[model samples]
Target: MTAVTDEGPGQVRGQVAGQGPGPERGRNPDEGSAPREGLPKDRGRPGRDWDDGLIARRAVSGAAPQEAPAAVPDDDVRPQVEAYVPSGSPLSPRLDALRELVGLSRARLDRTDLAEAGRVLDEAAARQRLSSRHTVVAIAGASGSGKSTLFNTLAGAQISEAGLRRPTTAAPIACSWTDGAAGLLDRLAIPGRLRRRPQQSGTGGDEALQGLVLVDLPDHDSAAAGHREQVDRVLALVDAVVWVVDPEKYADAALHERYLRPLAGHAEVTFVVLNQIDRLPGEAADQVLDDLRRLLDEDGMALGEHGEPGATVLSLSALTGDGVGELRELLGRFVQERTAATRRLSADVDAAAARLRPVYVAEGWPGLGERAREEFADRLAEAVGAAAAGQAAERAWRRNAGRACGTPWLRLWRWYESTRQPRGLDRTVFAAPPEEQLTARQRVEQAVRTVADDAADGLPGPWAQAVREAAVRGAQGLPEALDKLAARAGAEPGRDTDTDSDNGEPAEAAETAEPGGRTGAHRGRAAGRPPRPAWWPAAVLAQVAMTLLQIFGGLWLIGQIIGVLEPGLLTPALVMLAGIIGGPLVEWSCAAAARGPARRYGQEAERRLREAAAGCGRARVLDPVAAELVRYREVRERYVAVTEFSTTRG
Candidate 1:
């Protein structure tokens, strides 16, 4: 049999007893009562009997103990306790280890994880408040809520100097029980002097209230924002809260909507004290308390009497110590309950754990595979090759035309003949005007751009943008690509030879029309002019120099034949001609022969642009997405662990 117990307000404590139906059915011989084997014995002291009764009630209600409490006898009770332990339950140590692992995973994620981890850590810290040994209960309210007055009343003296002046408490003041445990003040970084409380001789021993650390924080509604900030900072780190509100402003929308509502999850560690209750008419106090309770409930606070182990709403006059005894008694009982420390610590840990969870979460992203990268590289290379081929072909055509017909001296004549005068030549053979013709260089550039644009198409959002940018860059590099192509073409200057003017032919009529004379007359006149006797014979002898010219001409012809027949010279010249003229022809032929390869290369270049775009996309866009995913995973893990812990501990 399992016995369950509800300890103060929200807590449930359970105890399991009794074995399953056993062979021994005999009753206890000494007591002569029904067998005690399966019955729960009430072992609590007289005054504490309610706790045991509650445990029995919880057990009867089927709320089994999560783990066997130390007091259960081992002989028969151990097996029953084992049976009651839930299967697949994660022990506290296991959960802690898992949380640590989650923390480590979060650390590896980038900036998004860092921010998320910070938030998770904050939540875990808040949760730890539930289990802290020393409770730093801060009394917070607007000015004239008698917060300082309440602080003094709680401390049993005029510890905080209260006045009508606005923002009277400039800084925080702490009061602690003198006989309480030591080190808590030091842990909180509070100096020993600030730990003083007003000496009080009481109906209840003051020593019972030891371990209580009460703080009088600055007013949250002070005109100075810094005061409010300080109040907020202290509130976050404190173990619990005592929200002091006067009857008139107990339901202040700003206070409830802003502070109270947001902190609804911390209700287990909160108390609402309606201070200055004496100001209300005697009968109205009860009504005001009820209203306050209802408001707190609306804000998700559970309210009851003190020592109820949940949130409580109480009306009191801090000035006159009205209801102060009940408050002291409740606080004393809470102090005596050692689990308060564990609860506060656990709560803080939970909060911090939550903040850290987002840092550990893992998210998936769209990634380009290795095959895609290879494909992109190949495409880019092919695009560049095609551009090179086109440029080479154009260059070859230009060189061949220049060698065959162009010259510096005759260029103007050729231009005039081709343009204005129709020399019985085909007009259709002329090169296009610069405006109409796309240069080899321009063609390459356009091709590259086209390839890039095609590759960029159909990509996802930011990736598409990246692909477009990469394509632009690749296209802009086309001029350099063309220059490489031209270098590889290796077109050299062609040989130039002029026709001889001195042929043994008669002068044309145009030539003979010299300004001086007709051709025959000129010749006869030249013949009549010279007849010097012995000197003329010698001049004729000197004029007959053809023998020397003949000898030199014969030698030059022999040298020409020798050069033409030499294998090295002939082979090189032939090869040069083939490359200059044939290279472009070959490219054009290949462009026709292998159009598939050329188009494929162009497509490949586009693919490369897409890949480079993907890398850039990861850097700019995917990184943030991955980080967010990491955060989400971390949060989910912590949320799971926390809910699990809450269930186990319930």
Candidate 2:
């Protein structure tokens, strides 16, 4: 039974035997549907067999009609559409990989340039969500090709009156074997009154097609541009297609050049039907079928001609029902396997991946983080004048040692020079010139730029630009940070006591408050002002003894000159000579011993400065560059997964 309800002018809704009420009339189907920019607004449905205009009715089981159409977001609502595929299925990995590709591309690449990929994803997502239980197949052909006759023959009922009376199929019509396909038809923007179901008695042997939805598309070579537009749109969405051709138009240039050649990748879900074959006389039918097979092969469609797994071509006569049963049997088996949807989606993914292949790396990925880090640290170390600081420390140690152990006359001369210079010897006696400081700052900037360049090397344009931008963002305020470190570079490290352990090892120096460098060496400080050696006291005592000997000899000579005692020139002179020579010998020994400690002190100063600079570099540039590379790596991984899925399937 069927119920008709007329809600408004030119608006109609139908209620079938078991299917529920349709949506309210006068509402646009596209208000909640996916993008269909090129489709026409509905005046009336096409391809309906009924004398009455645009009405479809079907009887279904109580449990057949789904409560909701595949409820998925439209393209306007969600920028990247994700389709539902059951986990562990063959199509699941590829679907997930394609979704990830779209997302990553939006984030890394220009959004404006992804129109084609986004369209593919949007259409595929909508189709998958519309009905997992249903498979949509379209029958398409040129004008007067008897495509509608084949469509009606496969449907077991008349679908459209366009086969021989007219030169073009005005629009598309849909015939479904089961219910719950209203959402899918809505996706194609089919009117509610235009969908139909085959008679219940006629569906007896078609149990394999329980969820099949067949669409009769308009003439592919129709003179009316609208008919051809409708054909292309329907063909793009259906899971599989059966192209109907007659003997006259079997090898027509319009069909092969327009539709067959471009969709060669979709051979797995394709069928080529040679309709109206009974019109061929004698063996002409076989000859035309063989020739059609040759043309399909030339069009790059994988075929079952050599028993390979590919498109199935067959001869049929819809008027006489000669080969219609064979097509039905083959189509039933195809629907039963349920690989059509997956195969179609896989082919779409293949096409999208091919277009995007040029933007990614063709070979192995190499990282430059470790090498860049070391080079960056070295550069910073050089920028902060670490080597120069070390040299100053060495010179200071030598100068202090000379002061402590030099002859009295030389010490007096050094004191006079210090007084004239008016500068203390305990600290950094030399200041960096303005020009040197400017050069150091420039080197710091150069180090950052160098790391940024290295990070971006060999990357694709967008990723390389992203890495350089990240480096710049992280390297802000680096010069000021170095200046703070350099200010503390000359500070002296404190020592607890001027004593050695029981094993004769010097006590460790206290930790410096400076950040660029860690604690100095145990025996000496970064400032090179080490604790007095154990032998220093002995040298000082020996110098005191020598001075006393000289003093005693001088006093004796004075006493003799004053006539208070007898003069002994040889003994006194000998004692004075020994004192003079012994003092010089002590000074020479001390200078030689301090050389080793001075070198060690210089090394500590340089090491501390280098560490400070390295820490600054890491904070400002290296870590951020690494983070950018990590993000790029993730994007690359998604690309790899997408390519692998397509490659393995192909």
Candidate 3:
């Protein structure tokens, strides 16, 4: 039931209800109330010996009782209530920001219990709908704070009983100025018996208080546990709170530490009313009010629209009715401005943002870099046997080319060599492609996992999970795709043979050159085929010239022997020897020249095969992995955006 009247800088008027120093705490406020059966011995303050009948009359007229102590002049106090206009207006923009944040983080929030957030959001919408019609303010305090008295003073009627009872108001009592707030009161769960309208509603003086719904909540520090629970529940849903404190317990740890400190952001809608201030000596009241302001500052509660030190603090004697006019006037302005609900919601958004900061704090989610991606692809290439395939292509090509352009005699032997199966390669393993298949598939899967792990490293849980999912999406079907690609690459190495088959002349010549004899010596003779070297025609023409020389020389020798021509034995014999030596020499030189072409042909075949194999590696393994890297990058960017958006400004 605390209420404040802000006059100017360094000055505030408020009301409270006790007469001694602030109380010493026996337990932590955070522990909540003890069990109902374990109530403290001094359940509430000792009863006042003062006349209750005199207090009630003074409260109705908003004046202090004659016997109460005199209060200090307002200017003599150094400053308790700073003039506070709530900082932000029209909470729609902040609400929209918060709603957008919720939408963006919906997936993450779904994992957590949503009750509190749901309640706050629901309350915000409800408050917005009723914004023009009502501002619900709660009057809450500890035992012996005279909160009920203050509630009656503000309403100008004794709606709530003000007495020495430990927990006088077990349930909330709602006093509405206007008639249209029944629904709002229903939302607050105020019983029909506890709801009341201003006593003299037709008086134009009540116009200032229109749209105001003041609720007197049960004592927060009540002996009964349920009373405190009711206070807490209402505090959470109320648009504004007036915390009532007597001069004695204004600095109660349970009040500041548990409630005020946690709600530091709600300072704009918070009013600190020092009740029973008339019980204190004039100077003592100022000292107590200043102390309460200091404690609130320590609670991190910013007071004014300019972000000052504390909420509006004012002193008043509810029993004496002192400061009641200022309190009513302040509340009138509070209702007329119609921003308490918006301010409360804005504060709510700030609190929620602070609580949720950890989840969206951006760090270590840079994702896979280009160099890492290339390295990953390289690793997969080796695992999938890309390099081995390339080398195999090169070897197969050399074998095919060797048979294609070798010397005629050697080509015949090489063709026969081609028919022989290669040794050492496990044909059994080849027969079961599954074994080879597993190797490539496993390699790819491991690579995918590794890259994903690296990308997710040092990231927050949700972003890291997103990175992992992206990697998985990119990796889907990759193993089978790579297997097909490798097979194609392997098949490419054998394509040269098909191309050779398309040239019918080579096959026919090859079959003709095959050894056709049974005996080993006759096999060599059958294997001898004329070399297809470029110099073969020159060699053959030279042999033809030599044969003609030999034949003519032989004819001349025969003529000499038969005395049918002039005889010259030296010339004819020399001619016969020269022709025989030169013909074989020419043929031998042509065979030597053909060897280089055969080697060069084999090298060309190897180069083509190697290119094909490397191409397969790029297409099958590197490309898919690169695609994954791209996805990782995209997710990383999104994570960064989320973090920045969530943290930088709330």
Candidate 4:
């Protein structure tokens, strides 16, 4: 009773033999000599000499045939044996999950590739996965290909009308196994009722066959292009395709070139059922299948038990039910393999995710640079100050002028105290030459205009225009502002004295007159009376000559005695003569030298007032604008730095 070891192919064979239920297994002598069960079974079948030719030639050339190593006994624990298998190693669940994910990704990519043509490939893929309980095998082919008859035979009823009609099955007809699984039909949006059949006897041999859903779509080569589109669209989403062709049209270039050739990669999920084989003789059916295999091989689909070369090929008559059971059994096996749906769904998701990648990319806004903001701020400040400087200078000038030309009473007090004598009215009032008289308002207006013009020079564009206009408006307001300031400053005591009569006569009259006579004299002066005569000369001149003679002469003592006797009359006469001779000459000399300098001084005083007013303009208006500009510059710099930091990090 030697224990059977699960090691080499011979050991597997011995185990199978021991487990046999019949004597035929022991009666077959070659059973023990057969290769392992995993090797391809039909490798030595007749007329399959294509693979055999390569092997035979290799053998004839005396090449040493390489053999696979014998499987080691599970009990053998050699040093090189990293691990041992309790039974045959099964696929890891992780590997299956990875494979499913890869398949899903591929399906999604395929859907996306087809999406540019306005088709929702992913939706089709999802619908296919959801309807997996049914085997949605579409029979796609050109017109007159006998697809309707095949559909009727597979359905086991006269479901499709097959006749000499020009076009048939304009829309798809879906047939489901169970009544409730008609939900599958509703999912397809097919408007057909569930026609229940008594459970057919042979349908339940394979449990996987119990829930199969079959769909019959419109012809791909129908005159209506929409029908062809429907065929193509349904083919992409279905679980498996059953390409039904007759012997004549099986080799039809249009069918093979347009659909079958391009869909070679989908061979695992495809089938080619050569229909109306009853029309071909027994030998022709086999010959046609052989030629079809050769064609499918050329198209990269290899035939095994499947109707497709790489897929399954079945030669059957829908009218006679030949080979229909084999088709059903094959379909059942395919349905049992439920992993394709998961694989396809995952692929679709991955592809859709890839397409949405571009939307997630982030962008930032452009910002003003720090240096540019700083430069603009500096220029704005300068422009503001320049416009205001003129007003400031005007204010300064008016202050100096007002102080210089203040009250004559103050001047008189100073003079009287210094010389111990009362000062004349003319000398006190007319002192300091009347302050180059002009109003502070007038000075400010002129200075504002000049300063504004200077500030506005060399500016360009809209900002320049804005700055110029603002400066002009600001300058125009300065005169009024300065007038107000001056009015307020000069509002104190003694302002009337500074503003009174030019020569002090009116003031002297006001001081000397009695109250009742003052009104009469003011009225008389209002009538423009002639000024009084300027005579104090005769007595003073006579005294001055006598005094000079007593101090300096004895030779002219007689002349001195005569001078003393008639001093009053002679002095008066000589004084009148000197006035007559020198009055015009003195007036001319004084007027000639003083005219231009006096005019210039008056102009300078006006100019200074204008400048002070301009400075006031800057202080009241432009300085705020400058402060605002500085704030703007600081904010702009911070904004630029933030944007720059974002860009660098990105």
Would you estimate the TM-scores of all the predictions?
0.42, 0.69, 0.62, 0.35
The 0-to-1 C-alpha lDDT of every candidate, in the order given, reads 0.45, 0.63, 0.56, 0.42
lDDT of 2: 0.63
Which candidate comes out best when scored by lDDT? 2
Off by over 4 Å in 1: 1-102, 105-133, 179-183, 186-193, 201-204, 304-309, 348-639, 647-650
Each candidate's clash count: 48, 2, 25, 34
Deviation from native of the Cα of residue 442 in model 1, angstroms: 26
Indicate whether candidate 1 or candidate 3 has the larger TM-score. Answer: 3
lDDT of model 2 at residue 567? 77
Tens-place lDDT digits, model 1, residues 233-273: 56655656788876545655545654665465556667788
The lowest-lDDT stretch of 10 consecutive residues in candidate 3 is 3-12
Q: C-alpha displacement of 202 in model 1, angstroms?
A: 11
* lDDT score, candidate 4, position 131: 38
Query: Which regions of candidate 3 fall more than 4 Å away from where they truly are?
Result: 1-90, 93-113, 199-202, 279-287, 305-310, 364-372, 394-405, 408-442, 457-459, 469-477, 489-650
**Candidate 3 lDDT over residue span 350-468, tens digit each:** 56555555455446545567766666666565554444333333333333333332334444554455446354221112122345456656666787787777766766566567667
Q: List model 2 lDDT by residue over 518-596, tens digit each.
A: 2223113334344466777877777778777878877777787798879777887788777788777878888898898
Ranking by TM-score: 2, 3, 1, 4
| Candidate 4: stretches off by over 4 Å | 1-121, 128-132, 179-183, 193-208, 302-309, 339-650
Using TM-score as the measure, the top candidate is 2
Candidate closer to the true structure by lDDT (higher is better), 1 or 4: 1
